[model samples]
Target: MLVGSPKVRMPPGPRGPAALNTLRLVQRPVESMIGWRRRYGDIFTVRLLVFGTGVYVSDLDEIKAMFTGDQSSLRAGEANAPLAPVLGSRSVLILDGPEHLRQRRLLLPPFQGSAVERFREVIAEVAEAEVARWSVGDRFRMRDRMRELTFEVIVRAVFGVTDPARIERLRSALVAVIDSQAVLLVPGALRRDLGGVGPWAAFQRRKRAADALLYEEIEHRRRDDDLGERSDVLSLLLRARDEDGRPLSDAELRDELMTLLLAGHETTATSLAFAFDLLPRHPRVLARLRDELAGGGADYLGAVVSETMRIRPVLDAAERTLTEPRTVCGWDLPAGIRVYPAILAVQHRPDLYPEPGRFRPERFLAEDPPPYAWIPFGGGIRRCIGAALAQAEMAEVIRTVVERVDLEPVRPEPEPVVIRGITMVPRHGTPVRVARITG
Candidate 1:
């Protein structure tokens, strides 16, 4: 417990001019965060147009407290309201307390143990097939290709949809929905449709098209007698029942499925994009990674994934809203205050990671990072359920790419990181050339 004078107030932070701060964040999220941390120490507050006032904490102890604190007092779901337009109000990302736990319990089995291994095989197959489509000496956007691969992997592995036409329909709809997500950053934009001409209206149109397909699939699957024996996430979810033996409703199923599709594919694809972007810049690291893949050593591959996540985490922070007043790191916070665990800042702390900007997979090989020091997947009960699957997919894809093809950066300089919806992605989509077909 942090002891302090009773008069101690909230941590130092930027005041007023919320629009300017929000613009700064929108334009350069990672740089703005680092600047504020340097100027204001471990904990600071920033006012934003969409989220109002938010306190960002980079202190490891404070972050742990926020993650492990009483569930009744901290609500991560509420903090995720901005995503509700796409994920739906009933999604696991928007539900809190007992409801969140129940949904989490129902969703856990499909992402763990043997289930993840099965997903890994599906990911490998998808990567190999996608790689086969890439011609040697062709220049392409790595992130776009990665997104297509990850999207297909999740659709097949999670949804169990095998029809090419159906898959294409879902793919088109999902892409449109994802591409239009920027409207979410604009307050009240999602609420006003503006007669089908505005961004919000366009998004709604795409969402409805996607929802129809998802619902059709769900209804069809519910009638299948063999659902119980299937291993995909949708199958498992359809068969799940709560303590009272009640199955999830169709609406519940739709929201959860959408959540998995978006969260599962988007972040993993971005992580791979960053990995590809970084590897070409460091020949020694790339050589070591290739050697590890060729020699069938998985540890180095895992380390590379870990290192990529540490350096370029897709989501800048994990957030929770306070339900009651609490003292964190000697700062008295009021109820309803939003607190952000600055994952990006914490992972880059010089004391925790020397020369943090350098891409060094060996740092992970040296020893495990301290608890909460390297939390790309956040932490505690709200930690990303897809963490294991994401890591596995990244390793398998990296290995497949390195074994089958040689790659080089399309430009001399590294791509800039830019904010896309809630994620940080390479501005130029990580352009690279397929130098040759190695195998």
Candidate 2:
């Protein structure tokens, strides 16, 4: 590809306050981005909700180049530093090089091998327990319910206890803190002048409280080294030792635990909510998927989850910075600029996916998608660490739900909204009604 100019014009699209354009996306990110794709080519620039410019890259080659670059060339941490306040400096999600690899290695076992297998039973049990709480013919917020269920599942699986009181309080506190959306680089003076300073202060206090409790858990586990009785991620992480034979420090363990808890629950909850909402609205697609799952059980359910991610992906994009000044997709880009591999946008491209908006589960079958064309967990070095574990949990939960309960969306359709402090969710909530699957 011939390299172009540093002054390359951003592909045509909406321009306004970062909040304005971003709110449009938050209201419906997938749709708005799709509209941009229709107008712009595979790549465009949006000066949206956060800080700085967001370059949306839907081209597979461009995405590959961005993710596979050397750290000095392209680093995830520097690109995602805005998340430092929420995820902490130690989180593996944003770390790079040796540190990133070290964290990922310590993080691998729990999500693989027999440890992950052990989670199957608990995941199904939790799904059953939550479904049991739902009444036939009664309307309820699906996102809210699933969010609670996911948090409880992680808490029990990681903490080895399902103390309802503690879990409830934690969930409420998390909701309060996460519900606030603070764009990176939004001036403190502007926020203060706008009278939003107090809420930001409160969010910080709540985040500290959450961290305090988590650290306490880490300390308690550190002091007690009886690992056999506990199968939780925390227990395993606490026992994890580096090549020098030292267990993870209190801070390292806390960081990993919080990362798993937050990342594990939020994405899964939003995905399930989207899948459930999309199912009934597209009866033909839903029927085919249900039939496939009914026939193949776990295998079919796995495919369904992958395909669901492609169609209605929970995450919009992941960011990376250019290492050296380079050209991508025939466009010249300078160093220090950011690249956003728009996951949903790439999955929706007509070139990659025919009838892109249609909910087609078959597209993810072994023979269907091109390499790197359909990434819900992402690809390359920076792929989601919990990908396998998440798939395992989702398979069990979806199977349990399909076998036990039949659900219908209470609303005409779901409206995905960015909850925005780190992740996104539906604006109000994805509400639905459930009835038992009859014999």
The prediction achieving the highest TM-score against the true structure is 1
- Clashing pairs for model 1 are none
How well is each residue in 156-236 modelled by candidate 1, as lDDT tens digits?
Answer: 888998787888899998888867777786677346876768777778889999999899989888888888888888999
Cα lDDT of all candidates, in order? 0.87, 0.72
Candidate 2 lDDT (Cα, 0 to 1): 0.72
Worst 10 residues of 2 by lDDT: 1-10
Candidate 2 residue lDDT tens string, 1-439: 1123446555555766778887777677777888887888788878764445657888887788677655567767776666566677888876887888788888887877467788878888899887777677867877777787788888878776567787776667656545543633455554342443565566677777877877766776667757656788888887787777877777777677767776788788888877677666776766665677678745556667887788877778887766566676776666666778888889888878889877777666657687778777776777887777777777777777766677877666456555454455666577777755542
What TM-score would candidate 1 get against the native?
0.92
Q: Estimate each model's TM-score.
A: 0.92, 0.86
* Candidate 1 lDDT trough over 10 residues, lowest sum: 1-10
Off by over 4 Å in 1: 1-8, 14-16, 183-202
How much is 189 displaced in model 1, in angstroms?
A: 9.2
